[model samples]
Target chain A: MNNYWSAIVNNLDPYVPGEQTKLSNVIKLNTNENPYGPSYKVLDAIKNSCNNQLRLYPDPESISLRDQIASLYNLNIDNIFVGNGSDEVLAQSFLAFFQKEKPIIFPDITYSFYKTYCQLFNIAYKTIPLDEYFNIKISDYLPKIHKNYIGGIIFPNPNAPTGINLELTDVEKIISSNKNIVVVIDEAYVDFGSTSAVSLINKYDNLLIVQTFSKSRSLAGLRIGFAIGNKNLINGLIRVKNSFNSYPVDKLASIGAIAAFQDIDYFNFTCNSIIKLRNNLINDMINLGFEVLPSKANFIFAKHNKYDAKIIYEKLKDNNILVRHFNKDRINQYLRISIGIEEHLSQLIYILNKIVNN
Target chain B: MNNYWSAIVNNLDPYVPGEQTKLSNVIKLNTNENPYGPSYKVLDAIKNSCNNQLRLYPDPESISLRDQIASLYNLNIDNIFVGNGSDEVLAQSFLAFFQKEKPIIFPDITYSFYKTYCQLFNIAYKTIPLDEYFNIKISDYLPKIHKNYIGGIIFPNPNAPTGINLELTDVEKIISSNKNIVVVIDEAYVDFGSTSAVSLINKYDNLLIVQTFSKSRSLAGLRIGFAIGNKNLINGLIRVKNSFNSYPVDKLASIGAIAAFQDIDYFNFTCNSIIKLRNNLINDMINLGFEVLPSKANFIFAKHNKYDAKIIYEKLKDNNILVRHFNKDRINQYLRISIGIEEHLSQLIYILNKIVNN
Candidate 1:
């Protein structure tokens, strides 16, 4: 440990995102990024933005991008807030709503970043155990059970490393349980599989929905994410964001994200293609003696009882295919694989055939 | 106030950056951005990076960009860290170094964001008053005044709003005084005027130097910034950054920053031109009955004794020009104007002649 680090720094267990390899020709199915490039309109907008105006700072409020998102969601711009990415938005949300007198609650098997954010903000947290099927139990999250030690709750829908989703009715149940306390629903994977909580925002003032352009919009490189909530919740996020960095989204990012939202046809085509491919991939994996979870996300969580997950991960890496394998006790046997293009999935099957069928 | 806001969010006084208008023809001069576009190489690199790989996550460590910066300063890659912008880097430094039991010190009139950061981090700070001549009195920072309440120190070189700079020897004096605590020297404007204390990073473990590409490199649209310091300090920042967001620098930002550094000749040419234009503008302002600071930066802080600064700001806005006028005391009478191209400045002078010389 470094002697100069603050107590907060010493306490932080930094979040480790899935590996992003620099090698060319590797079939990437680790991080759940869309396998397709953004729309031509997005590329054109970004290229057009590369001018002398590159010298000027981007809009701190992200007014244009926020307005575009709000219009798409049938909400007011006051109900929206944009940031560098959903990770940045998620981090800001932890600072804004989750750091409270009582310990916050989240799913133990959800996005690992929740724990990291709690450490960085010095907020106490309790992780309610995910059910045996890797599902969230809404009843277990009631404030009465914790006797007022409940500050708030946050969990990603179509949860990472599990690829299971909570229905809108169940999500609303949790929000309704914590009326006074805030409830954040991270929708990073929502576009691929489920209905957004945007409709629930107007009804529940305590509901905050965080989404990203990184997955479905395929603009991860541009780094844009946003939050949709009531005006007061939006204002709290704005305060935390402005205090952190005024211009988190650069000029090109703002323009590029706005263009992504406008290209509805292209976005729909790519997302649907991933869903079809995901279904086919799951069938193929099950045929190969692996048990795959029912997934609505662009990824699947699968395990084969006969094969060691670590060994398969290593063999795949050696063969130029990368997938995520968590080493934790409960998840060590499972592999979280992102859905790639048709060609990428075919290549992955070919590699698995050589390794597993043997 | 919002009831859901955290104690920190409730306590925040968020920073307000300069206006970013969507108009096509305004002579923008409020934010201190470079008037020139980035080199052709930077543009080509960004275009080349706009491929299907945009779906993949950017390298969280920002290895290539950090390597280039480290080599420029003759330091190890471990000694460097990069972020979305210098604002992000500066914000992280506050969380990394200045959040301690002792109070930090900065000039009362330095970059306004320092105070905002303090409020957000809940760090106690004491602002040392700048002398009547609008200069940083380095000796006033002597540790003898406050026994151990000094957590660290930070101020912009060629200090903001006033555009006055401190010599290298004087900067060393402050660093020497705060030997035990981390001292951050923001060099956001150093490329335009003063020497960077980067070289002193090796001699003193407590010194951290922060710089940004937003100004001199003319890549504000890309949002790239960095810090060079002792390995431990850089490590501390990495922990805080990773805990917050894994990939602060996006893919295009990484590639564009590397291209900007490689085109040394183009970077030098633009910086020199801006310096020359700043000199000419200062002379012109003095001729027009305005008292201007002796500036080594790309901006000049000036006041016309006969005119109100706020009125001038409003008049310029009506005339489709924008310059910054802080409504705070002691500096409310002055205007901070970014040095635009010769055409922009000439047009500004023409408008001022109509308004002031009338």
Candidate 2:
């Protein structure tokens, strides 16, 4: 630490993203990135955008892209707010809605970035423990039970590392209960199978649904994420964003995401493939004496009955395969595995069988 | 104006960027975008990066891109911090260094975003009035005079909207005088004709130099910007960035920027062409009875002696030509005109001649 650093810097324990390996042969699954490439149309649109127009700044409002997202969601353009990624959107959301006298609430084991954002913004927060089954318990969020005042609430639907999706009714119940505070539903993994909270947006003025192009649309490298919310909420995010970086979403990323949305067939084909692969992988793991969570995401969470999770992770790594093993409380034995293409999953199962049988 | 918005949002006066129009026939000169396209190599690099790897997340650390920048600046890779744009870099800089009990100081008429950032971050600030000629007055910043507690110092080199370069010795004086707080030298317009304070980074550990690809390399649409500073300051920025957004730089932008640095001849060609255009534009404006500032930037700031600035701005717009006019204190009479191609400038001059003669 230097004398030049602000006091906030001393308190910031920054979020560490999952390993991004440069090694080509590794069966990378840590970050839950899509295994399939984005649509050909996305590639074409990005290429076409790489010309003279790049000299100019991208539209600060991201009008066309937001318009496309609005049309897709059957909402107005003002209902959409885009950013460099969902992480940035979440950061802005924390600042826009959660900075109050009372603490915000989220699942303790949800996306780890929430805590980091709280520290960075000096926003007070309290984490509610997930149910023993690793599910977000909606009853815990009710004012009658929670007791203490909350400024806001946010959690990933189909929570990370434990791909269990919170049911739509429960999501609505939490929103309906927290009528005063904003309820942010992080839907990063919602498209795989789970229903979206986006449909509830019109009914709930305080509901904000955050989504990304990274997992389901397969454009993680492009860095595009957006929020669908009430126009006022979108305006609040826009205020924070404009105050920070006017054009967080770059031109090619915006163009590519628009193209990804245009191709429903391609999006469906890829999401379906990951789901099919995830189901087969789950059954194969169950047969090998592993208990996998009921996953609605592109990835699965499982712990082998006989073998230690870290040891299995190491063994997979030794065989040029990689999966995430969070060395945290209560879930240290669980492993998060992203669904790769068919052959990659087959190879993963073959290796896991050897490790578990031994 | 929503109840859900954080209290800071109510206090925030967001920065309004210069108008970006979609009119085909308009000679756009409002936002100071580079008149020329990026190097062919940069475009080629972005196109080559448009394939399957987009399914994966970009390098969260931006190691390769940082390495390229470090080599170019002759600094260690640890000294470099890349962001979405210079605006984002400035925002992170505010959070990393300038949040203090003491109010930061800057020129009253500078890049308006600095004040907007101060407001957004809840940092107190006092603006030192620029000298009568709109040049940054170094004496006012010295602790010996105009003394109040100061947390930091930041202003664009060849200060924005004025395009008046601060002498290297004067910049050194300010850095040396303010040794305790972080001194940010925004070199967004440094490549045009001014000397950068980058040479003084090793001498002054508190100095952080911010630069961007928008003005010089002409890739504003890609949104790449970076800072060069001591390792400790860079680490502080990294901590904040890691907390906010892991991968602000997309894969294609990183690759494209690397290619931008590779083609030095192209970079020099474009900068020199703009400089040459700027000189000619200045001469024409002066010949037309406008008092042009001694510009060392890609844009020129001038005002017609006989006409009102807003009227001239409106007349230019009537002719499908656009230039920036700030409706603020002290600088309301001036027009900040971005230098365009030879033909665009010639048309501008022809239209101005008509307006002045009429």
- The reply for model 2, stretches above 4 Å from the true place, is B146-148
Going through the candidates in the order shown, the clash numbers are: 1, 0
Residue A21 of model 1 has an lDDT of 82
Alpha carbon deviation, residue B226, candidate 2 (Å): 0.3
lDDT of candidate 2 at residue A324, scale 0 to 100: 92
Model 2 local distance difference test score = 0.93
- Where in model 1 is the C-alpha error above 4 Å? none
lDDT of 1 by residue, A135-247 (tens): 88877877667665788889888787788988998999889888889999999999887777788998999999999999999988878899999999999999988888888
Q: What is the C-alpha lDDT of each candidate?
A: 0.89, 0.93
Candidate number of the best DockQ: 2
